[model samples]
Target: MINATILSMFSLSGLNDMTTKHRVTLFSFTLLCYCVILLVNSALIVTITLEEKLHEPMYIFLCNLCINSLYGTAAFYPKFLSDLLSNSHVISYTGCLLQVFVIYSYAATDFSILALMAYDRYVAICRPLEYHSVMTKHRVIWLVCFSRLVSLLCQAIVMIMTSKLELCGSHIEKLYCENWSILKLSCSSITINNIVGFIVIFFYFGHDLFIVCSYVQLVKSALKSREGRKKFTQTCLPHLLCLLNVTTALLFDLMYTRYGSASVPQSVKNFMAIQFLILPPLLNPIIYGLKLTQVRNSVLRLCRCRKQVKGLG
Candidate 1:
């Protein structure tokens, strides 16, 4: 009975009533942004992978950050670009659920990896002698897998719960699928879903708290020595910037989606809806590439080698 009541398709209002000219322009700009995200992130991932010097734990985590940006954006950009060109903005129920899972899991994995990076930095700076033994190749792999698997499981449960929803409505006010939007369509009580959702939210919020505590200890340790301060300034700054970028973007998205003023302009509303999709994926790689000296040198070396090969060909 519940399965029968679930809507087969969802109607999205975010792109409705756009003029033909506006659609074309929006499509072009969005396409450009997606390409840049792919190019920059892929370049960074390639640089880190090909450069043996970047095989350390910090660089490996940075590589995961780049890869996750690609992973997350791949879920949104293609579908969004298609919606921009299509007359009807609709999605199948299964497709919506998959999108929700990929996107939120991307977020979960991002926070997880960033938290791990904070710990890596703490060990390198605060406990220099034990850094190698603690952040070994096997250990890093295990940590990455554990974090991602836990996130996937949590999101899987949420999606399973969402799939059971007996939707009374089909219209979604936003451009894409999200947990809150899907939950809003349910015809019956959603206490269980809400509870599970908050549990997941707090779980990732705990990542933020962990990062803060790690940094607090780092600050104290770094202040004790000039070398410690320099090390923190050199490597840890990029992680902090990336963390701030992602967390702030997420906060903006959540705040606007849940409690934002409807009186705000539609364009602004749209930006708030997609800011996370745009900013973090685009900025994370760039922050690391520019701020980390080793990464900068490695990327330059990679680019020069590419040019030499091209000339020979």
Candidate 2:
């Protein structure tokens, strides 16, 4: 039935009929939004890092969040925008591989960063006495480095392993480089490849969940203090929401792979795409500025300074 439906759709649209204008329009709009998001995120990171008053674990974690979101957006947006603006759907073999590698690399790093941020919050709120020692600048730097390194290693292994296979065709149905779609195009036996993909997904999701849950438990313990409970919840809510977004998206991807197309509705898929790509970057700064008084003041100050400079100029 799936094959018949695909054949019917192909017959209607014609296999070679390339009316990609609509797709290009959608990509263009998304790309513009992402560019704005990247700019704002970068500004926030600069503010946090250069401003002496913003030097704390909370702001440090915000800096990491901004950096991770930038990396994630960078991995996918350049190629997407190129394809959109130029109407060039023809990605080179190497380009496709690089996209797959970079996308997953940043994705893994993003997840790791969220986990570390959760840990930071847990330490800051729950173990206030030892927060500074526990979340030292050196330690955070090492964790960031280690997170990206591990992601790179995983992506390297996947790329090397997949490179050995002969591709049957280049008819990737999806708009972007997805592992399952690429794997489906290979003429070679993909049993081992599929197995590896499953294992990677399992470990990635399980480990991230474990880390996040640990922080949740720690937050629970901290919330027992009546004085800190309200502040702690306010501080942690945004991160919790962001973590939930990531986890749900990963779970949906896994379910889609396991059950094929029937696993999830198309609406759910579309919503997830928007949530992952569009929502988080917009939310992070707002969450910080609104939840924390200092960030709001800093942003207001920056705005006033910019206006003053513009008036003088």
Candidate 3:
């Protein structure tokens, strides 16, 4: 039988190897990264919200994506910054679970939103005539809400199950709290947790497969005309790239968490641990903002408007 007393805190061992001399540099870089993520994502969200031309289904989805990025990073960056400047890297039990919920849910919603984007492109390119009727404003709002709700519910179940476990220890090897890392600490059998975890994984993997199939259809339709090809390159390509980036980042973290070798350098492991949080949030907005003509033009127009206002003042 496991002990009745639950652990109140966990020590994150990922930062144990860092020397004092390197801590300041690491902290500075991380802070700058977080600031940039905030600035770019906020800019995109504001631009999309304010630009009447960007009120369509695609840009609305992009705005939600940026919002998710901010939501996920908010859970990590502040705590991480504080930990970096402090000597100890400890998180409360409740706080740990909350982090798991926010970060993983953020990831799940990312995939969900990407899947929606794929379908949006599929309809836009493959069925252009029906695009307006199909992706109506009401439908777009519902889809966005569905993506976020599904992710939150799934992650909530995972967090609740994890909360019930009787942990054997409080030492987590990763830089941040994660569901799998916490499960590893359980003293009792986690058969139910494992089953539920697999179900969640399978559900999200199905989402990825759906995205792939949508893109396949998109590719087939795009090949039929030069205009279709241009549309796919301008819109679908950025979504594909963002999808690839997030998937690769998640895969690195999964491999490291599940089958990582102790022989690997701690620095490499740390990079793997935080890459998802770093890359997607920082790069996704930039990719869409620069690559998508609509977004680029809207952003430039907003800038010009602000510049003219400043000149008048």
Candidates, ranked, TM-score: 3, 1, 2
Candidate 3 Cα outliers beyond 4 Å, as residue runs: 1-4
- RMSD values, in order shown: 1.7, 5.4, 1.1
On residues 178-244, what C-alpha lDDT tens digit does candidate 2 reach at each position? Answer: 6776677667688998888777777677767777677767667766887567756677777777777
User: Candidate 1, which ten residues in sequence have the lowest lDDT sum?
Assistant: 1-10
The model with the greatest TM-score is 3
Please tell me which model should have the higher lDDT, number 1 or number 3: 3
lDDT of each: 0.90, 0.68, 0.93
Question: Which model is ahead, 1 or 3, in terms of TM-score?
Answer: 3
Q: Rank the candidates by lDDT, best first.
A: 3, 1, 2
Cα TM-score per model: 0.96, 0.84, 0.98
Query: What TM-score should be assigned to candidate 3?
Result: 0.98
lDDT tens readout by residue for model 3, 231-280: 99999989999999999998899777888898999889999999999999
Count clashing residue pairs per candidate. 0, 0, 0
Can you list the residue pairs that collide in candidate 2? none
